[model samples]
Target: MYKHILLASDGSENAVRAAKEAVKIASCTQDSVIDVIYVVDFDKSKSDVLHSGSSEAIDIERRKKNSKVIQFLNDANVNYKTTILHGKPGPEIVKYANDKKVDLVIIGSRGLNALQEMVLGSVSHKVMKRVNCPALIVK
Candidate 1:
């Protein structure tokens, strides 16, 4: 029954599954729009390690991933829009939902246990706590 659905993706397989689910839900509802967001978190150490040879390569790869996600939406013929943001994944996702006044959010859960979640905070947990909108978490 969601009018505007916000789906967060990290280009992971789990996220991709969530995207497919969101699209299916949207297809059943009339006048519904799906918003897909990809967050690019800036980790200097990770960036340095990954981009040892060239930073341009990293940028190109990021763009390619973003393009692939957008292409998937187009190929599916789903009414959707894509947003690429730079920030911590959880907060950025929550903020975008609130700012856009989305009816619901569909997120992928990494299936982290309490201990693992405590050590490395899960994005789904953080967004659940912070987001005012309803969330449908997919595994």
Candidate 2:
């Protein structure tokens, strides 16, 4: 019975899987509300800017990336709101989950940046370790 669920998404395949899991879990309780967060990685944002040519373009691309998850929740009748945050994904998601006092945090095991995850670590790993609530990392 998780009343407050936080889903950290990066629009990757695994993220869609996580979104599915979030919907299933959130549906378990009538009062559940999901907080979807798409954190724009600072380093990746620079690359996106260079490829996109403008901030507005970048925003559009971001929305397009996350649209599937949003649409899925809508079709499933799950109550959720998405917030876009600009920062390092791991820290940003952790801060948001803790600050919002969510009861559950769900995220994909991997993200859009596979090389970065191999080089440094995964955003899901960081979130699972730091969140104040139960963290569900979907593979």
Candidate 3:
């Protein structure tokens, strides 16, 4: 019965699965909106320009990741919006969800190895700890 759902995607297979699940949730909740966010780690990019080809690259990647979800939402007549943020994925997602007051946060598991996750800390794990609302993590 969530009125607003946030879907965080990084264009991975697990992310696509999470998008599909968010779409399904949106379709079932009347007057609900699905907010999709893709975070770009601009700080990590070696490119010096802020508004250069990197912007284009981000747009292309967003479109590629969002097309299927958008199509499904359109077919289901669900309302949705997308946003691109520049920051670390976990913190960005948590901030967006809180700022937008989303009722739920749905994200994909990065499928990192246990040792890698222990060392690097997966985004989903961070979101789960930081988000105020409920979070659904899809693997």
Candidate 4:
């Protein structure tokens, strides 16, 4: 029933799981499409600049990080497109979901400790709170 599904990925193990879930959901409908989002936060950008040899290398490394998610989607033979956004992960994901008016959002959970989550506020928590649509958090 959901025609537009948004998936937020960080290239983590949980994110790969989320990709699989997205594929499953998208497959439920004939016209469903999965929109994968990967955010490049300022901290990561800074670190990449500092450590990488060139911008081309940074781009390559970023793609490497997202390879698993892409691979899963491709192997599943699903209709999906990955968009790279530059900003805080939570806010960027929320913004995209809102602007696109997606029917559902699937994101990976990092499973942070209580104290760590309370302090840092996991991105999944933030997106779930702010997004208008139903959100599925994959652990």
Candidate 1 on 1-139: residue-level lDDT in tens?
Answer: 8889998988777777788888889999988999988888876438645765676776667657666556667777888977878789999999999998899999989998989999999998788788888888998
lDDT by residue (56-125, candidate 4, tens digit) is 9988899899999998888899999888899999999999999999999999999999999999999999
By summed lDDT, which 10 consecutive residues of candidate 3 come out lowest?
44-53
Candidate with best lDDT: 4
lDDT of each: 0.83, 0.89, 0.83, 0.92
Clashes of each: 0, 0, 0, 0
Candidate with more favorable, higher TM-score: 1 or 3: 3
- In model 4, which range of ten residues has the least summed lDDT? 41-50
Q: What is the TM-score of each predicted model, taking all chains together?
A: 0.81, 0.85, 0.82, 0.91
Give me the displacement of residue 25 in model 4, in angstroms.
Answer: 0.7
TM-score of model 4 vs. true structure: 0.91
Instruction: Kindly provide the TM-score of model 2 when superposed on the true structure, using C-alpha atoms.
Output: 0.85
lDDT of 1: 0.83
Cα lDDT tens digits for candidate 3, 62-91: 577657656655676668888878889999
Candidate 2 structure quality by residue, lDDT tens digits, 1-139: 7999999988777888999999999988998999999988778866897898788998898999998888888898989998999898999999988998999999988554777877988778888999999999898
Best-to-worst order by lDDT is 4, 2, 1, 3
Per-residue error (Å), model 2, residue 88:
0.7
Error of 4 at 93 (Å): 0.4
